[model samples]
Target: MGGSEKHAGLNNTKLTERLETAFPLLFASIGCIYLSVKIFNPHLKNKTKACIVIPTVDDLILFASHRAQIAQYRELEITVAGLAEASLFTSQKFYLNQNSHINKNLYTTVISFGDTKWNTQQKSKTSLRKYKINDERATHNYSIITKILKPRYKIVKETRNQKGKIKNPEYSYISIPISKELFCDNLTNGKPFYTDFYKLAVPNRDKSGKLKYRIKFEQKELNEMIEKINFDYEAEKIFIKACHTAWKHRLGKLGSDSKKPGASSFDKLVARDFERLRVALSKSKNFESFRETITDFWSRAGRIQELTDGWEKVMILLEPENWKRGRDLALLALVSYKPKNEKEETALKKLEFDDTKGEEDE
Candidate 1:
C-alpha cells in the first residue's frame, strides 16, 4: 500500500509491514527539514578538528537513526574535498544539526570542489555563466533538475584544475586541501571508496556504443571492491559501518535459493546499536530511577524474551510506575541480552549447507 490512505485501511496486524515500507520516506522528509534551516545563520563557522566517514549509501540509515547521539558530540569539521552532488547533499544534511545552538553558521569550513563533476555528467553539462556557485551566497539546490539547467546564463567549462589544491581560501573558515587518500587510503591503491559511484555517474557504452547500466563483475570482485573502500581507514575521522548485507551468504555459494542473512551477524549488529544507546542514556539525570526501573522489571516482567517481544509486551512491561517512559532503555536491554550460550547459533551453522545439492544429485 501507499501512504495514509493505505495506512488507514490496514488493521493492527499489518501495521509493522506498513511501517517498514514507510520508514525511508519518513526519514527523508525529516532530514530535508533539518537541512533547510541551516541557510540564514549569522555566526562564524565552526573550525573544530573533526571528520565524518560514510563508506556507502546504506550507512546513511544508521546515521539518520542515531543523529541525536552524534549531535551531542559536535567535533571538528573534516573537509570533504571531493564533492559530488549526492555526497555533498548527504554530508550537508547529515552534519547540519551537529550543534544544539544554531544562532550562527559554524560548519562552513569547506574544501570546495565546484559542481563540475556532477554538471559534466548531466545532459546539458553546463553551469550558469553569470551566477557561479563559488561563494557563501550559494544555497544548495535540493532539486536535481533545477541544478542542471543553466537557463538564465550560458554554460562554460571550469578554468582551473584545483584537485590537490584549495580554491577560494579567503571565503573559507578553515580551508585545508584534503585528498580522497587521506580519509581512506584504498583510493590511492586503486581501491576507491566509491566502487560503483563512477559507473553510475559517468557510465560506459555497450558494444553498439549505446549507454546502458549493465556492468557485471564476479561476486568475489564485488566483495573485494567493498572491502577495499575502508583500507587503512582511520576510524577517528573515518566512520566505518559494518557490512550492510551478509556478504558471505550469497545465491551461489550458499545455495540456488539464497540463504537468509547470517543470524549471528544481525544479532551482533543490533547489540552494537543498543550498546551505544546505553552509553548515551547513562549520562542522563533520570538514569538512577531508570536503573531502578530495570531492576524492578526483572521481578515484574518475564526474562529477556519478554523484552524482545513486540510493542505489546514492551507496552505492558513499561506500563508500571517508574518505568512508564523507559521504552528506549528496555529496547537497549532487549537487543543486547541473549540466552546463555545460544543453542540456535550452533544449530543453524550445523544445518548450513546447499539444500539444492541433494535434490540435484537425485
Candidate 2:
C-alpha cells in the first residue's frame, strides 16, 4: 500500500509538470493569433476603401480619366488630398459633382495649405540655399499630413536624397510610417501605364531613376516657349476646335441630303435640281473643305519641317475657295517655333545634333 501511494504521488507530480510547461506555449499561440487578426482586419477593410493622393491639378485630370476604372468596385472610396486648388480642377471635382457614379456618401476632408510642399516653399521667405535646413514651413507641412491623415496607404516619394540633398527644393518623396499621434509638439513645413492602384500611384521617375513626387514648374521655360511663338496658343486651340466643328456640320448636312425617302417619278426628274444645288454648295467657299485640303497638304509635308509647314497645311485646307484658310494657317505658323534667346540656339544644337552614329557608320 505504501509503495502504491508513492507511485500515485509521482504520477500526479508528472501531470502537474507537463501542464505547467504547456500553458505558456498555449498562451503565446493565442496572443499571436490575436495580433494577426488585428493586422489583417485593416488590410481587408482597405480592399474596399481606396486612398488617392494627387500632388497637382494636372494629376487630377489624369485621375478623372481613370475614374471609370474604379467605378465598378462597390466598396471603393477614394481619399483625395493634394494641392487643394489643383484638385478642384481635376476629376475629383467632377466626381464630387453630380456626373459620376461614385458614392456621394463617402467622406471628403481638407488638409491645410501649409501642409503641401508646393505651398510651404512658396510661402517661405528665405531664398533657397543648398545644404541649408529646408524651409521650416515645408517640414511643418509634412508633419501635419502624417499626423492628421493617418493613411494606411501612401503614394508619395521622399524629396531628400540619400545624401540629404533637397533635389527639387520642394516636395518630399521619402516616407516614414506613423499612427494616430500627440505627435511632434513642433509644427513642420512640408505615371506608370498600369491600371491597378498600386501601379497607377507610382510617381514620375527622377533623373536617378527613383520615383519622385513634387511640383517642379519651369515657369521661365514655358513663358519663353510661349513668347517665342508668334501666334497665341489660345487662338490656335480655338482655331483647331473651329475646324472640327465646321467639319461636323458639313458631314451632317451631306448625310441628311443623301437620306431622302422614295418619291414619285416627277420627284426623280426633279432630283437633278437637288443635285445641281448640292454641287454648287459643295464647290462653294465652305470651311470644311478648306480645312480638309489644308490639313492634307500639311500631312504630306516632311516631319522635319517646322511650324511653317503646319501653317502652310492649314492654308492649303482652307484655300482655293476664299483663301481664308491659307492666310490663317500662315499667320498661326509664323511664330510657332521661334527661338526664345541666344541660349536657345545652343540648346537646339544639342537637341537636333544627334551624335549616336558617326558619318563613318553612315
The segments of candidate 1 whose C-alpha lies over 4 angstroms from its true place after superposition are 1-26, 29-65, 72-75, 83-172, 180-362
Candidate 2 lDDT score at position 232: 20
Clashing pairs in 1: 43-104, 46-106, 48-76, 49-76, 50-76, 50-78, 53-239
| lDDT digits (tens) for residues 1-362 of candidate 1 | 12344356557634444676677656543332111111101121122112222312234565566555434432122233222322333434443344522112222222221224343322221221111122111122212211221112223433434574544332313222111212122222233233222212122344564432221212223333333322323320111111111111211122322235643344443333333333333332364555563454343323333233343433433344424224332332232222233432332222222233221110
Tell me the lDDT of model 2 at 295.
Answer: 54
236-291: candidate 2 lDDT, tens digit per residue: 43344333333333333434454567533322322333233222233334566545
Query: What TM-score does candidate 1 get on C-alpha atoms?
Result: 0.18
Give the whole-model CA lDDT for all candidates, comma-separated: 0.29, 0.29
lDDT, model 1, position 226: 32
Residue-pair clashes per prediction, in order, are 7, 26
- For each candidate in turn, the TM-score is 0.18, 0.17
